[model samples]
Target: MKRIFKLRSELVFSAAISAIIAIIFAIILKEFILGSFLNNSKNTTEYVHDDVIAAIEYQLKNMNINDSNKVQKYMDKENSMLYLISIVHKDGKVIASNNKEIKSIDANEVVDGKKTFKFLNDNRKNLVKITRCDYLKDGCYLYYIYVGYGKLENENIVGIMTGIIFIIIFFLIIWKRISYISEIKSTVRSIAKGNLYERVPLKYKNELRELSEDINYMTSEMEKEDKKRSEFLTNISHDLRTPLTTILGYINMIKNGKYVSKDELNSYVDIMNKKSLYLKNILDDFFQYSKLSSKDIVLEKQKIELNELARQIVQEEEDEFIKNNLTLSINLMQEFIYIYVDPNLFLRAVNNLLSNALKYSKHNTSVEFNISKEKYNNKFYAIISASNIPEEPITDDEIENFFERLYKKDLSRQKEGSGLGLSIVKDIIKLHSGFVKTYKENNRLFFKIYMDIKF
Candidate 1:
């Protein structure tokens, strides 16, 4: 609600500023430009007035009443706009007027001093100036000067109407924007309270639309992460309980003296030890995953030969493959290819991949480890892949989920190992600014890593 009020306040402020500027501009235009034009018009009408008055005076002195045509002709020429002249007697009788509509002059209106009055004629308001001619001392001559000011009045009406229209338009824009921002505020509040499904309505274009899209994207990613975290808890609990239950059961059996022979007792101890070791491995992987997921992780990176690294990791894992009844093969590029990486973390990622191969490979199947150079977009990268035939065929979707935390293949959940191996590998590779992928070709499931090669 406060946000909405703030928006409204800002809009009102802007409108107020605009209105002030418009009013100032109107004042400047009226006082400087329009005032100058009106002044010139008044001056020109005054010149015409003096000339008409001089002609009437000259005629009254020299010509007779029958010779009033000369005065009427002069008045006719001047009466074309805003000038009406008349010759009136003291008894309210008009001898000649340029306007034929003036049948008689009002004797009461014939005053001594110059006086201004409003005159209405032909649906227009005019200013009238009354003058009594002093040349005829018997109060014989009087003139009415009319100047039409209706155009100026119309201009004032237009300016007022324009100001009213501007005010209405500004308010309409403010109302629309306030309504839109209110919608966004409401939706954001709902999302803050954990309603990630709420999304802002996409109205309008450009900047507002992009903001809505970004908010929706952020909410969607948060929802996915929430779901993954829930699943990680559930799966870790189940995996940890399995090994713990096995070790406890063996220990209880030995405590009750249930073994029939001494060899059987030794066998129980061996199985318990193996189960304990499995639990330790799971705990270790969990710790590593936790450390890698933290934001403050630091890496000590150094340049290392990629081919030599792969060969060494594979050789270390060769005996484990043989013990699992699997054959191991290694093919490395003869030319040396070096990449910058943290040796410990990179070794952990490679070890996890090889261990995963041993756990899932079909009996007596050949596990292939290789390092080769590849080019993409004019940049060289070293490709390290470990491939083997799985005991069960893995689908494309399952392959994609392999790098997600606590995700395990349904076929291999009964196998002995933590499901975090591939996830940890993914995290380690991300720290090195590289990527990992899995694909199956020719019945061999392949896990590949791509690292940028720098000289």
Candidate 2:
């Protein structure tokens, strides 16, 4: 059931199986051929030479072979189209023959009473073999057998068997590949039909395994994105509806004449205005974040002094920090670090960090804004960091997903503003080819943006 094996091993296995089947087939066919030849002749020797040699050796043990005519007559009697029989006399004279092509043979070349020789017959070489026999007083009854056709036929049989082996291996491998490809196509089709959980079977340990794993990873990511999109729509709708409901309720109170004093009516109007502004802020953050998150988000990048930009942002938001009873401190390095960035997007990213710090920091505590050039992994980066002590303690898990869209750490979910500010900051920084990270040290949370300054 575990179908994981190397391609090389599979091919070897196919070849092994093909060889076994071909060998069996060759043996069966050889027997059938020898059977047909034997059945055509009148000789009844039972042992079948299912090989290249269809020999019929004559045993003249008691018969007198000194009569050349008698030997010739006997040779002529046993001659068949399947094989030729000739008697080689001791004096190297080929006395009797069925074919007149061979005139004589060297007696010394007949070693141990058997020899294989080649001669030109019809402009082609024909192999002839002498079968083993005894030396008589007149001459030895050498069975000069023409074995060319039998040998060629045997070789052809072997060639046919080898061809069959390769053909079987080719088709077996091709069929497996086609079946696996079909399975992959089917799984992909299912995934395309919104079955994001469907996966290819990983029963094979081959190149396809890597491909399957990659596709499975892609589908998992798409599933996560789909779930996240659904959640985003639900949360945004709720956030939008909450403020609209409050504003509508205030208008209804005024319409129904529920308020007795003008001051109370004015108070309702102020609250409505504040809710409407908060709603607008939420919508703006959502749209901006969505735009930056899109693939088409383009940045108009230019070289600027990063330290100067940090100072300008701090100065712009200094009044807000003071009004919120928080001290804003700037710590910039002496050297002016310059980096390529989209100025508006970069400012937005820095403003979100400052806003988050202002929103969370304990009153009367100082928010530290630092800008410096740093070297990490042999690359120079411009680092902008802000550190502040939060009004409420935060856990490591909360900080881990701090930049995720609509992920609010406030357990009561009563916090003002949509939770997309930090997420937008992350997207803007990414568009500029930078990264943001937040960590806690000395009981103060630190949010840092690292942008490559070397370029």
Candidate 3:
């Protein structure tokens, strides 16, 4: 709610600033530029007034025409704007006005010291000026000019209406856009509150639209990563607790003298030892995974004979096969296949595959460890395939899941192993810019390693 309020505040602030600027600009146009044009029009009209006054005075003095009709016609012939000319007596009597529609005013309006050259009435309905004739005095005749301008009034009405319409539209758009920003703020707040499934819908375009897309993508990835972390913690607690519980139970029984004989006590000790070993192995694998997961992991690389490494790993794991009553068979190309690799990391991956082959290989069946070289994409790679006929039925999905952390093909964990082995193998191979593949061929599950051979 606070975030929404903040967004609204910012939006309103920006809009207010824009509105103020627009008003200032409009006021400048109205007060300075447009006002100056109106003043210029008024000045030109006054010039016409002076010319008419001069002509009338000339007629009264030289032509000596006392007839008001002749004087009105004389002013009309010289006036192109058709201004209303009125001749009046000083005691407030109008002699001649061209149109009665023109607003009336006192004859003293244009007298030298009296409110000279102003509008006739309070409503600004007419521009009027009165002049006293000097040629005929005996209660002197007063001449008045009244200009009723419709164009200026119409322009003012149009300007006022346009300003009102512009203000209404600007505020309407601001209201709509502020509502959209509030929607974004609410979505972000939901995600922060752990509602990971919430998503933003695309409504409008611009930088804000692109920002929404980027935010959605980030949250989606964060959700997946958070889920993985939760699962890892759950698995770790269970895996670590099971072994510790077994060791604790056996220690308690031995301390309480629960073993009936020497053999029973010896068996209890053996079981405790195995449980402790299991706990240690789990911790060690987790530590290795944590180390490799860091971005700063650097491998110590060297050139090694790929065939020798594979043969050596097989020899090392021969005892595990013997314990399980499974045989180990190797098929090598007999060529010196030297490749550059981090020997320690490579051996760990090789050991994982060999151990997995022995663990699932059926008794009285043979697990094949083969090493050969292949060329693809104009580069040579040392290919190692560990093939075994498994004791259990493995599907395509299980093969895919094998490399996922804590995934157990045999949920019972009878193999006495953590599920991180194959996943660690995958991470190590990927770090070395290599690839791994698992497939079924000829009723055999084969794990293949493709490592680039340095020229």
Candidate 4:
């Protein structure tokens, strides 16, 4: 049989899978959040810078280059970011200027554009803006604004830490699951090695734990079957060997002329004949058991008077009942109890039950036999019971298991039987779409057969 696959890689793989997904999610979320904030920051900063640039443009358009003092003072006051402005006329005249020198022009390099670069590897920056004067027709002004920032790095670190924490927790849970799974594997391995007693002891419950419980139950049933098989072999060996040995000894004596008298020779032949018959009975039990135990065993169905068959069987065994010092009493319905069944197999089953009842019945005690009809769940049945008043009272537990092959009890008819009688009885009835049950009631041990009566 192919073994069941119970180990799950999904728990371990799910952690790694989800971590990858979480990391991707964090990156996307961080960029979105910070990108929006940076965009808002740019908008706010540009709003103020536009106003300052416009104010400078207005001052240059109306004010003359000669009154540089008023223009410089107004530019200094209007620039909110502390912009340093320097202007050089077309004749190289220092017309309107601030700061120590005209910035980025010692080499007489034409300053034509804005230059923004971070200082000290930090997001803080120096932003330089140069604009030509439309009003002066001579010089251009340079605006230098230094912008400082420090918080973006901290937010990136925070986002990464949040993702890492989530991954760590997920991995820990997966590790715990793996540990339990390994324990279950070990227990399963032990069971495979024929240690049916081992069990997986989970402190808590999960899917694997439930599977463990099922495995434990399977192991218990296997143990029972193994025990029964061993007992069956032992019983079969003893029953076969004893009779064969007796027959062999008698045949050897007759062959060797050890029995000189004709009477002695006849006695030896009779004894051998009886042993041969006994061996035949044992073999028959084995054959019938083998055939009946099959799941696909077929029955020859017929409508038969069930109570009439019961009466005939009782009459046939009447001599043996008397020999055993036991009496038989029957209660049967006057109306016919008809059942659909295999007639020959059903007769064997009934005979097995009678033999069992008589064998264990107390000497001079009455064995009660009954045939009746019953209706249950809209289904009709022919109910037959053969009960023996056992020498010792049979308990409910003993009665329940007595139908099992080779089942043993204290009154213990098992050792005397080939042990297939009751088992054969059970299988035969079940093949007829009926059930056999054993019960103890009113101080009598009963073997109750319920055969379905289909119209």
On lDDT, the candidate that comes out on top is: 1
Q: Write the per-residue lDDT of candidate 2 for residues 337-385, one digit (tens) a residue.
A: 8888888888888998999998889999999999987777798789999
Question: What's the best-to-worst order under TM-score?
Answer: 2, 1, 4, 3
lDDT of each: 0.76, 0.74, 0.71, 0.70
Model 1, span 1-455: residue lDDT tens: 11223444666676887677667766665565445544445443445446556666675566564456775675566565556677777666777788867868677756554444333444432233333333244555656665555224535644885597567656665666667778888988899999998898876554555677888999998888888788777767877898789888988999999899999999999998988888889899999998998868899999999888877887788898899999989998889899999999999998899999998899989999989987767977799889999998788999889998777786446786667899999999999999898899989999999899868
lDDT of 3: 0.71
Model 3, span 366-438: residue lDDT tens: 9999998878688778898899999988899999988887777887656677778898989989999899999
> What is the lDDT for 452 in model 3?
84
The TM-score measured for candidate 3 stands at: 0.63
| Regions more than 4 Å wrong, model 4 | 1-168, 375-380, 410-415
What's the C-alpha lDDT at position 181 in model 1?
74
**Candidate 2 segments exceeding 4 Å error:** 1-161, 169-181, 322-325, 362-364, 391-393
Q: Cα miss at 352, model 3 (Å)?
A: 1.9
Worst 10 residues of 3 by lDDT: 126-135
Worst 10 residues of 2 by lDDT: 41-50
List all candidate RMSDs to the true structure. Answer: 11.8, 9.2, 11.1, 11.3
Clash count, candidate 2:
0
Pitting candidate 2 against candidate 3, the one with the higher TM-score is 2
Q: How far in Å is the alpha carbon of 144 misplaced in model 2?
A: 17
